[model samples]
Target: MNASLFCMAIFSVTLNAVAQIALRKTMLTLGALPSSLITAFSFLTNLIGNFWFLGGMLCYAVSIGAWMIVLSKAEVSAAYPLLSIGYLITAAIGYFFLGEHVNTTRLIGIGIICIGIVVISRSA
Candidate 1:
């Protein structure tokens, strides 16, 4: 891929990963959301009012636009696999920013994902 397209792909995936992390943090901040229909409605109302949650939604919209550009520049089959890069990004964010632990098995899984991405990129 050209540098511009590659950068956009990376940006798109980063936004995807970051949005998820932000949303998770937002939920954690909210704490102990209910599963019942009425309580869920109240939860949704509060969630929608939060700026961070809205920002996460906005990130998704922007990421989708970037992803479309990536699609235009590259094969969907190739571009889609690159989204796994988000898993790596999220895992790193969770580890460094959120104080989340990464076990050996998770590291190995991430390694396998990296290998698969390399294989897929070579195919393109």
Candidate 2:
């Protein structure tokens, strides 16, 4: 990937990571899902009103548009692995911004993923 393509890919990945985090945060606020049909409407209403949920969806929309541009210029084999960066990004945001825990094992796993992403990008 050239510089512009790489930038676009990273932008898409970042937006997607934000979306995932936002959606997860929204779910944390919303709690357990409603079981009954009657309660489902109320759940939907609450979800529709959630700022985090709306922001997440907006991120997803922009991410998809950016991803389509990336896909048009790059090979899927090269591009898809880039999405793994999302895991590291999400973990960092979760820990720093959301006060979520990041255990040693998860840190190790994230390190391994970073290494893999480097190797994969080099192969592209």
Candidate 3:
């Protein structure tokens, strides 16, 4: 991919990561749900009111638009690996924002994913 396309891909990946993290943050706000249908409905109703969740959905819409741009510029097979970059981005966000742990094993796995993305980008 050229500079603009690559930048778009990175932006798409970043937006996706933000969406995923936002959804996660939204979920954390809701504690364990009751098993009753009425309680579940109430919980769902409250979830709808969250601005962050709505923003996350908007992020998803923009991410799709960016993805479409990437697809128009390159083959899906070559561009798809860029999606996995979301995992890497979200891990860091989760660590800092959510206080989630990122131990050696997770770091190693993320490293492998990074290597794969690098190889795939080179192939395109």
Candidate 4:
């Protein structure tokens, strides 16, 4: 891949990771969901004061733009698999920031995803 293309891919992936974290943080603040639409909207309108969700939406917009740039230069098949990088990042963010635990089996799964990315990159 060209240097610019590689950077775009990485940026896209990283932005996606950040977005996931932000959304998670936002949902945490929002607490439990309401059953009715009116109640849900009321809660959301109130809870939307949370900065994290807004930030996540902004990050998602940036990520989509970057992803479009990447797709313009590369095959979708190649670029799409790159999204897995976001999962790896989200896993780390969840573990560290959210105090979530990853068991040995999940670690193995993450390792597999890492290996897959490496292989895909090499082949690309």
lDDT of 1 by residue, 1-124 (tens): 7778988999999999989988988888788888789799888888989877988899999999999999988999988998999989999999998999999999999999999999998888
Top lDDT model:
2
Best first by TM-score, ranked: 2, 3, 1, 4
Residues 9-118 of candidate 4: C-alpha lDDT, one tens digit per residue:
99999999999999888878887789889898888885667799889999999999999999999988888988998878888989999998878898899889989988
lDDT of candidate 2?
0.96
TM-score of each: 0.92, 0.96, 0.94, 0.91
Report RMSD for candidate 2: 0.9
TM-score attained by model 3: 0.94
- lDDT, residue 102, model 2: 100
* Candidate with the greatest TM-score versus the true structure: 2
Query: Could you give candidate 3's per-residue lDDT for residues 37-56 as a string of tens digits?
Result: 97988888878987778889
Give residue 109's error in model 2 in angstroms: 0.6
For model 2 the local lDDT of residue 31 reads 90
Q: Which ten residues in a row have the lowest lDDT in candidate 4?
A: 41-50
Task: Give the per-residue Cα lDDT of candidate 3 at 11.
Answer: 97
